[model samples]
Target: MLQRGGAHHRRPRAIERLVGAAKPTASIRALNFASNEMLFLQTCDIPSDITSTEALGWIGFDNTTAAEIFERYIARPDPTINPADLLQYVYGHISRLLTSNLRNLPRVQAMRVVGLNKPIRRALLDPCYDQILWTQDLHFWVKDTLKINYATLMQLQQQLGNYIHQRRSKQKQKPASVHGMSVVPPPAAELRHWQPEHTATVNMIPEDHNLPASHVTVSASPPTIREGHLMLYKGRAATESINQDGPIADDGSISMEVLSTCPGGDFNWTSPAQYWTPEKDVAEQFRRWAEQRCPYSETWLLAIQLSPEFARGLKREELWFSRDWKEYAWYCKKTKQPLSKFNHFWNDPPAGADLMEGHICTGVTTAISRMKVEEIQDRIDEDHVLQVGENETKAKQCVFLSAGAINRLGREMRGKLHIDIYAAIQSQEFSEGLEAIALK
Candidate 1:
């Protein structure tokens, strides 16, 4: 009776084995995605050398300069560096380029806003850089320079696939490394404490602990501070300012102490600390400091400290949107830094369109929503633009939502929203929408 039972089970056991063998593993899926990306890249007419001055003008880089910069970084190294580390280094390098008044310039500021990753102040002395770089401006730069955007995307994906495959392959050989499991452990919920209110939206914010994680547009928005007499001062000034003017006395000047008088030895500047005042004299002083690349004075630091308060005191229209200000605010909030260190990027017109959104979090949304390609939610997918709706300026504009806001809207709203990213990419609209608004 036992032998007969065993004989009857053989066919079913064979069918089960075949089904299990046919299933794709994580590594296999990654490679398949990477292959498709590589194919798409091969079809593009990527320039080896671009000589068009018109194209070069958009990013402030000449053809030769752009090509050199692109080539220097585009190629894979003999010994590959981790993708995460490379991305971090690139971000820091670009951040260094924004010195002095450059951060306040609309074009540069726009680029910063478009770049992914919120800035975290590492310390007082260390140069603050965001952890990664993901910006549509970079795509424009690559397209203008005639470099391979596709390669970068594919390389990252390929390396990730290899990593996963290697780990999976070694499960039996190195059981100790795997902690005796047949597969690697799932990613830790880094956002567990900070998840959105909705249980369904818990996975909405993609997080992968596994992988390590541009631009040439010259569109000029209005400057945050108009050309005027800027007073640099120490001590307290009324945080409130009327009209477009900051806190200023009747003569358009304010008193501020000298940087040398400050308690900190870290700053080397000896000039009178600048205050947030308007006057030709103060403006000239700012110009001089910016040109000289002088260390920020105590009053300047005070100005930064009080900028948020001053902005809050102003009417909605009086406040100007600045990329640095928003980024700084988000960073301070994330780190639990005091309000004195925070600066806000207020929408001058008091509109949602002007502000950028923060990444989803369980704790809180720090910034406004930004529109990027839906594929950016996960880098594995091929990047392509979606068709803008009849009245919409950009494609799939509804997905970027704050956790709190989405929860309040209720869960039923979730089923109503559908993003057909793959379908969008496959459609003819992808090529037609090259000039679509960049992901903020």
Candidate 2:
């Protein structure tokens, strides 16, 4: 017992001797100060309540000293000190500094000092072993599987929230609104840049709702899947080939497995598909239902059915609803006239091909789809290719843009710009707007 007590007493004395003997070199001073700080912390058991400045001030340690201490902790000076214990001490000091009311913390300066002209390999052997200790509020820095003590992390989160609230309260007070005065303009009539035409709202009905009383005995022969037509299957975004001619059932229901449809294009195939008997003579009702669900354009359906309502409020708002490529191509094929009809520039012959031979563009054509040449190899037809007279060997979708409209699509799609539909009307002389004055 006496030997153990003597050893404990001699430990702090050895650290004091190291500190007294340490030269003015930054690394040596840092090593000595760290030893002293660690010994003090272990003896006092004040990791929770002690402030970073208080600990540093106890031995008059500077930012360089703090940085040196951090480096030694990370380097893991094995046999001399425990890496885990030292890491815990470092975490405590930095965390206290971060959550403290100090106007400026030396934590960043200390990090910068250590990182200056230092190669990463010199500090750490394995990148995975490189640990970052962050307070819970800075969740991006904190990993999903936390390495810190759960109780300590929770306490840090509370501290951070309290600090933030106090800072915000001191910075500014909430403004009070005047009676009968509009603080902001009303919402615009047209859809804003952020708003999408359609979104799934959560007015959920039972998944298994009873069929209408009048439609009790209802059935129909399964429709044949059309060729060269886009079929919007549930759970998939990219187009894939489906069985055009499959075996039919005697009961009028389809047998093929189809994934359930949802708001997003993603399909989950884990759940088994089920057959549902169609309501007899309800083509008009189905059309109305389809219109209500996807109002921008007409949607053709096959065997699959949509639920009565989406279970959750799913807000999937895209600039355009990506239908099956076939459906999109088919729609374009039907509604659009050929680009050649509008402009003679589109009818120009290939630069290398015989001018006397002319080009396929002179021939009557209707719609064109943006299909890559390699994608449609050997199957060169109107739907597969357009006579742009350019080399289509490049690994990109080929399109004949005769007009070459300004390409602002990339920047606009990034969501930086917003349409101010009300601003235009508000600026006109016919509009009257009010400005506010502060109350005495």
Candidate 3:
């Protein structure tokens, strides 16, 4: 039975099935009706379960057809009708139908408003009309899907108008000065000449061994010299030790203090001369790390972390080595740690499970022959203990468990102990039972 409004409408079950299967055909028909007038009736005839009234209700005539239909509706004037009122009524009804359904909307409205002789078109499109006809069906569609009501739609239209008006106003208000003026600023005023009272001085001293007191002479004229300043010798050479060997300490070992200060006038130059070595050669370290970690069973999970960071560094060495590193490394920058460190293990499945089985499980398993299940299970148990210990020390931390591990534990309890795994785990009894078995 097909229900319409509150009544049961007699409709064949087979027809309903056929209609469901024919939805694509119906959509095509609807599209055709919008573009072609003759195809409209053919579409209307396709649905045998629908009455002519129902079909007509959905069939929206385009503007040309609506105007013609409206004229026909008005010509048979019963004495009670005023022509003006009748025309308005026909226009409103046709316009409402035209706007409501997607199948009939803009195309129909365009055909109708344009089809009305030129005078009618001018009146409908006039700014004086003020009210635009809109379909309740369209209003309902918008309200249901996007929560937009008639009042909101009107507000949006007003906002659009304001935006357009503001843009036009701005366009008209650009500065008139910008139109004719040259863009370049005038040249800066010429700089005034200024000179310092004291000119720069050059001072140099020749080594004692490089000159003889007898040969040196004082002169008022600029001295002829190369590379160093010449000093006027007015007196006998001062008694100074001219040590042939580079200056040395009394103990015969060269003193750092004397070497630095004596040579460069109290300057410490060791810091600038010091060599630097990195804490870790990231490329070499990553290469070795990748060689060791890449072939591991957990490589996929590791690659997820390593690949990105390796890429971010843009180093060929980092890229080559971390390529096989399973964990995503780039995530560490945003997360403040490598993916392996930040991501909860329990939130992800064991790395190799996907390859063996179609899906990853989140609990205990009975299947053990695939690999060293016992060894893996023991490692998982130890990890859980370490996690719990950490959690106890850090009260706010939450521990994550892998789905595969949890699934295996669940299967073990249910199969061996005959316990409901969900209830046991939820009640915290599963851990108690495991403790008992470990102690035994």
Highest TM-score scorer: 1
Which regions in candidate 3 have their CA more than 4 angstroms from the true location?
Answer: 1-70, 81-84, 96-440
Candidate 2: lDDT over CA atoms? 0.22
lDDT digits (tens) for residues 24-84 of candidate 2: 1111111111122211111111122122322222222345654565455556657365636
Full ranking by TM-score: 1, 2, 3
lDDT of 1 by residue, 319-391 (tens): 1123332333233322333233222222122321122222211111111122222322332111222112244
lDDT of 2 at 337: 30
- Compared to the true structure, candidate 1 yields what TM-score? 0.22
Sum up the clashes in candidate 2: 2
- Write down the TM-score of every candidate: 0.22, 0.13, 0.12
Better candidate number, 2 or 3, judged by TM-score: 2
